[model samples]
Target: MIEFSEVSIAYQGTPVLREVSLHIGEGELALAVGRTGSGKSTLLGAVNGLVPHFTGGRLVGRVTVAGRDTRTHRPRELAATVGVVGQDPVAGFVTDSVEEELAYGMEQLGVTAAAMRKRVEETMDLLGIAELRDRPLRALSGGQQQRVAIGAVLAAGPRVLVLDEPTSALDPGAAEEVLAAVTRLVHDLGITVLIAEHRLERVLQYADRVLTVHDGRVSAAEPAQAMRSAPIAPPVVALGRLAGWDPLPLSVRDARRRAPELRAELPGAPVPAPIEPGAETLTCRDVVVRYGGTVAVREVSLSVAAGETVALMGRNGSGKSSLLWALQGSGPRHSGAVTIRGTDPAGRKPVPRRMLAALVPQSPADLLYLQTVGEELATDRAGEILDELAPGIDPDSHPRDLSEGQRLALALAVQLAAEPAVLLLDEPTRGLDYPGKHRLTALVRAFPGAVLIATHDVEFAAETCDRAVVLADGEVVADGPTADVVTSSPLFAPQVAKILGGGWLTVGQVAGALR
Candidate 1:
């Protein structure tokens, strides 16, 4: 369905994808896994002629998708043969209503009204998004928006679908729904699917073949079953290898088949009960927040106790970010009150004490403006903070010049400069590499402050935090120990849930049996 022959692309005279060659067969599901800026998105763009045509890149070699040569085909011409869903769903939305959003693509294709209506209904049912047909596009959650976007494309009946991080912003439940819909589209409808994703654990099982890309080159392309023991395996895949299972299973049910044998090989230990409550550090009492005329957060009550780490989870626009900012006293919260260690941290008082509640914003760039990473840390504190958080990062290197992961570490080091007792981090691992994410997780776990992380990375929350809370529709729907809460809540359960019989979240715990 798609073929790349010695293909290379450069943006603004700078090379991105170099001599990439691969073939995606018809009605096959292929996953492109790679770290950020490794040219994964560039490869996807090449499918629909977006790389050279829209991104102003120099394209070399031959590229074809759905029997059309990409070198000659423009994005508009390829739209009928190929449907591309980008990383951000909101970026692709062109209408206010869900029905209109789905029909927009068909209208552009000049399909008759009867055919468009029939296709819209069929696609909506296939994606199980019929209930969202009447909702305003702006008011819908990110996951809902993503589903609608996929439905819109499916309605067009394209031969091939290219999705870039479709579930990156979705919750575990929503991601599953999207994946299930894609599976149906591939198996039932016989559509060719190519997906680029960072969350490999969720999609690896569904993928017919796995293509691992590193530094703009294909490192490995093999059957998913044969690639189970690769060093860079997901937690459960590694666990399956360690558990001595032959023909390692990709999904949880497959792993469960070996559960009895796994149990026999282990020395059973008592699973600890959920921890008791501690002294309140940052407490929110019936908080209400509004934007313009619409309420963003209702009477939501939650607390981050002293010396504890809590994870806030929900769909996008589900008030996770709003609640995090509200704790800092800068958000739209008005009715409810929040107190930090017996006093409102939001109140104007001593600078030193107020700085105790440090907030790490969603974007690291917001906190990074220093000419040199070293100078940034040095300018903030005399020497002690720099010595602790930034042990080896050059104190004089420019922050903007560093890699995404490096910049994240540098930003985090600066956030820790205040030595805040209550640290608030929002999606700290969004663009980080595996190693960078591991380092950040360790940093968060080692910190002594009361930490509240607002994130969608369930695995990270399970590994770093002791407690987890689910915030949906601006209210705390569930709260308890991280493992227990995640395992119990359907909304929060991730691929890791299938492996951790008692709901374990970390890769380390999965490795314990191997040791």
Candidate 2:
């Protein structure tokens, strides 16, 4: 259903994809895997004519989808056959409510009203989003917005779907829902699907074929064959490699079946010493954050000590983001108080807010407005800070031109320039690869003050956080050591913990015990 013939693409003379050739069959789900800025997005864009046509790049050779040449057809012309959902769902929204968003695509295609309504309901039910039909798009959580975006495209009844990091913002359960829906489309409907995701573990099990994009080239193979040497892999694959397991396991269940021998080989190891948390650096007492009549955060109390890293994890719309905003003194706090370094942030005057805390919102791009990276770094006289946080980024490149990971690094550099006592990051690893996530982990470890991160990435939290705090329905559900909190919950457990079942939270911990 999709074919790329000697496709070489460039942007302003710089080649992004070079002589790539691949074919995706009808009813096949192909996964694109690669490190950050490794042409994954560029390759996906070529499928629907977004690369050279809408993105102002040069395309050589041919890309055909459903027997139509992308070179000869614009994105709008191919919309009936190819549906594309980008990484940022909110940016693609064109309607006020979920139902309207789903109908808007069919309306553009001039689909009959009766047909549109039928497809809308079917798409909503398919994705398990029927309950959110009337909710305004603006009030939905990041995960909800992502689901609506997918539903909008599915309602159009396209022959092929191209999704870019479709499950990045979703929690484990919600991600499973989205992936199940995609699997149903590929099997039950015979629709071709192409997905690019950084969290390989979540999607690899659902993919029939894997496409690895690296060094301006693309290669196709089955998941097992591709993962053997793929630069980006999930923790289960990494564990299999480290333990010398043959035919590396792709899912947690497979890994668990092979875990007994490895567990017996390695002796019980002591848990590493926890970080010595210093005196209270930030404290929240009965923080009640509400929006109109909706209680987003309900009388939640928490505290973070100096030199501590705490992860705030929960389901989508569990008030994790709301609590973070309230603690930053930027969002509504119907009741309760927040104090940073013994001074209430809402009442402080002499000391600047930046000095007290710095928050990197879920959408890092929203905090950036400058034309170039150099201009963004110059705002706070942050030459030294940029050099420290992100050393290799080109200062002259446009911020929009950078990759998702690079953009996130730039945002971190800009925020860290303040040298605040408390640092808050919301979904910091959304688009980062393993290496990028490691670098972020190192940066977080180097910070001297307290840190609070709100994320759904269990592996990232297991690697970097010292403690875990879970919220449900706007209330704290669990708060304890990171290993204990994550390993005890099936929904939040990392692959290593799920497989080994010995309170191990990450591969690093297991490797250390083996050594």
Give each model's whole-structure lDDT: 0.75, 0.89
> Could you tell me the lDDT of residue 294 within candidate 1?
72
Off by over 4 Å in 2: 139-142, 347-351, 379-391
What is candidate 2's lDDT per residue for 1-515, written digit by digit as tens?
99999999998888889999999999999999998888899998999998888888899999999999998998999999999999989999998999999999999999999999899989988888899999999988767788788789888989999999998888888888778888988999999999999999899988899999988999999998899999988999999999998898999989999999988977675476658988899999999988888889999999999899999999999999999888887778889989999877775442487689888888888778999999998765466655554566678889898877778888888888778899999999988888788888988988888999999999999999999999999999999999889988999998888888877878888788888
Error of 1 at 56 (Å): 3.4
The residue pairs in collision within model 1 are 374-395
Candidate 1's error at 432, in angstroms? 4.1
Q: TM-score: which candidate is best?
A: 2
lDDT per residue (tens digit) for residues 1-515 in model 1 = 99999987875666777788888898999988776556777788889998788867699999998679987889999888899998668878999899999999999999999999999999888888899899999888777888898888878889999998888777777788889989999999889999988776678889888777666666446644545634356656666767767777777778777776665655453254455546777888898888887777888887776668888888777788888777876666778898877767665454654466777776677778768766777655524443443344456656764544456566777767677778998877665545556667777766776889988887777777888888777778888878778777655665545654655455466557446
* Model 1 lDDT, residue 4, Cα: 90
Model 2, CA-based lDDT: 0.89
* Candidate RMSDs in order: 4.4, 1.9
lDDT of 1 at 247: 78
Candidates in order, TM-scores: namely 0.84, 0.96
Worst 10 residues of 1 by lDDT: 382-391
